[model samples]
Target: MTDKVLALVTGASRGIGRAVAERLARTGHKVIGTATSESGAAAIREALQAIDPANDGIVLNIADAAQTAEALKAFLDQHGTPEVVVNNAGITRDNLFLRMSDEEWEAVINTNLSGVFRVCKAMVKPMLKQKSGAIVNVSSIIGTTGNAGQANYAAAKAGLEGFTRSLAQEVASRNITVNCVAPGFIKTDMTDVLPEAQKEAILATVPCKRLGQAEEIAAAVAFLASSDAKYITGQTIHVNGGMNMG
Candidate 1:
């Protein structure tokens, strides 16, 4: 067995997920990142392997419950239980509530909220037997503040936070910590395409007067997953640039 801590990070092909995987690997964790496709997984593998040959990647679609369960079981059988699990896979189907199709709401809720439930259910037993672990679910500031055209996304993220708290209570006795990291407007592909005027408008609301980097969110996740945060559980650490300080 490797001396390094084992960590599983989902949706690690790009953006916040990619940064989280890299940060954990650089911090001495043996990371196994997941992407939805073979090509994306290959990219994650290539990137992480450069940091540590023990690090690897696999294809996992959290939207599929059976596949998630089966894949996680096989992964645990092969790599043992991970000390850390980061649920970062999420999709956005932005539409006004009046215009939003059932598909839009279901897709976001299924992937963002229920998908985390599936992953947690699969891993919680192993983590209980191990008796120590950290789970960081990536939420969004919009979940709290709400946003136009993001009703489904907001509802899913809000539900995720509630789920985090409930699960944390259930597992705290086992020394398993479940927490959330709610990021405000971060600089990613999603934000990069915004009109320059819109981008400026967003920055104006941020006290930092700038967009956050993916690495910044990664740092918070790294801390929550570290031994230093062993006593912390059922908490939501907001990583916005003073955008929403509620």
Candidate 2:
């Protein structure tokens, strides 16, 4: 049997999720990262395998309740309960509140908010039985700052933070810590496509005058998932380069 801590990271295909998965693997955890598509899963598997052969990847659509339940059950039965779970899968349907279609709002809410609920539901019982675990959900600065053209995204992330707090209270006695890492303007593909003027406008607002790196965000998550943070729970660690200091 592997001696490494077992960790599950959702949305490991790219960006923050990929960084978090790789960070956990390099830091001595046997990570199983998830992606919604087969190709994305394979990519994650390859990247994680390079770090440690015990690390793996799988296709898991957290938005689908049946699939999430079945796949998570199989993973638990086969690999035993994971010591850490990172809910990093999320989507954004950017549009002005008045212009947003019902589908756009529902899709973001279902995948971002409901999806997390499903994942936590599947893992919390196992963690309770084991009496120890860490759950770190990735949130966003938009949730707190209320960005324009991102109402759905903001609501989902805000809801996620609230959920983290409540769940942490419920499971604290069982030794499971739940927390959130709220990132601001991160240097990801999503931000890379912005025009130079837009990028400059964004950078001007951050006191650090730089876009946060995925690795930096991963570091915060890593800390929260580690035993070093055993006493910290139900807290949202803002990693936003000094934006939204509230």
**Which candidate number maximizes lDDT?**
1
Per-model TM-score, in order, reads 0.99, 0.99
What are the clashing pairs of model 2? none
Clashing pairs in 1: none
lDDT of 2 by residue, 156-184 (tens): 99999999999999999999999999999
Please provide, for model 1 over 115-146, each residue's C-alpha lDDT reduced to its tens digit, 9 standing for 90 to 100.
99999999999999999999999999999999
What are the lDDT figures for the candidates, one per model? 0.96, 0.96
RMSD of each candidate relative to the true structure: 0.7, 0.7
Q: Give the worst 10-residue stretch by lDDT in candidate 1.
A: 65-74
- Cα deviation in Å at residue 240, candidate 2? 0.7
Residue 147, candidate 1: alpha-carbon lDDT: 98
